[model samples]
Target: MTKLAEMQCEACQVGAPQVSDEELANLIKMIPDWAVVVRDGVMQLERVFKFKNFKLAMAFTNALADLAETDFHHPGILTEWGKVTVTWWSHSVKGLHQNDFIMAAKTDELLISGK
Candidate 1:
């Protein structure tokens, strides 16, 4: 199977299917650093990336923005002094989708690539 980071996100529509429990189990393993969280009754994939300082955090946030723009799938980003919390979910489906996992893996790649 193709790695999540190598997979391109497909256009998600309002009736798109959410990831199944089996798929979520497998995908979550690929992004172990991220947590499966429920906020306001919505299931989301979230992770807090640490940086040395505010500047670094902002830089990472900007890089993530570029990725989101390219995929046309945005995340909820909380940037702070030394950390950035990213939350991925498919608003169109009102739940978690494969794109969220793909983006989460790519987000991890940003750190690995030192973006």
Candidate 2:
């Protein structure tokens, strides 16, 4: 199977079907560090990336912003002194979509690439 990081995101529309339980089970394996969270009754994929200091955390935040622009998908990001919390979900669908998984994998890649 192709790695999620290597996959591209598809345009998500309102009413798009959220991932099924089986699909979530499989996809979650690829991003084991991420947590599936429900906020306001919507499922979201979330993870926290740690950094050395505020500067590094901000750098990663900027890089992630660029990546989101490139993918045309955005995530809720909270940058702190030593870590950044990223939450990915399809706002259009108001739930978790495959795009969330794809972006989560890509976000992990940013760390692996030393962003």
Candidate 3:
């Protein structure tokens, strides 16, 4: 199994993969501060990485790009002066998939390490 597949909730294991939209909504609602969102056919988790200037932001963007490429699960990244919006959705599925949440968790891990 892939890394994402290996990441299973102990109690929720042995069931169907991925989550329904209603399940997703309830789960997301519980995590009121995650900034993880689903809308307009996208599953996104946005984080504002603060930096002193635009150069630092660009550098972080490049680093994030490298990480995305290594994972083979890319996100829609919008880099501005001090923030980069990362939206992760499985294009093949035409909706949110398990990979999207896995990637979001991985991205959050990355931000923690960068700090």
Error of 1 at 3 (Å): 0.7
* lDDT scores in order: 0.97, 0.94, 0.62
Off by over 4 Å in 3: 1-18, 22-48
How many residue-pair clashes does candidate 1 contain?
0
Q: Write the per-residue lDDT of candidate 3 for residues 11-60, one digit (tens) a residue.
A: 22333345686767764553344576668855555556566778877877
Q: Which candidate, 2 or 3, would have the higher lDDT against the true structure? A: 2
Candidate 2 Cα outliers beyond 4 Å, as residue runs: none
Candidate 1 positional error at 60, Å: 0.2
Model 3, CA-based lDDT: 0.62
Pull out the clashing pairs in model 2.
Answer: none
lDDT of 2 by residue, 14-115 (tens): 888999999999999999999999999999999998888999999999999999999999999999999999999999988889989999999999988976
Give the range of the ten consecutive residues with the poorest summed lDDT in model 1. 34-43
Pairs that collide in candidate 1 are none
Per-model TM against the reference: 0.98, 0.97, 0.65
For 35-58, candidate 1 gives per-residue lDDT tens digits of 999988889999999999999999
> What number of clashing residue pairs does each candidate have, in the order they appear?
0, 0, 0
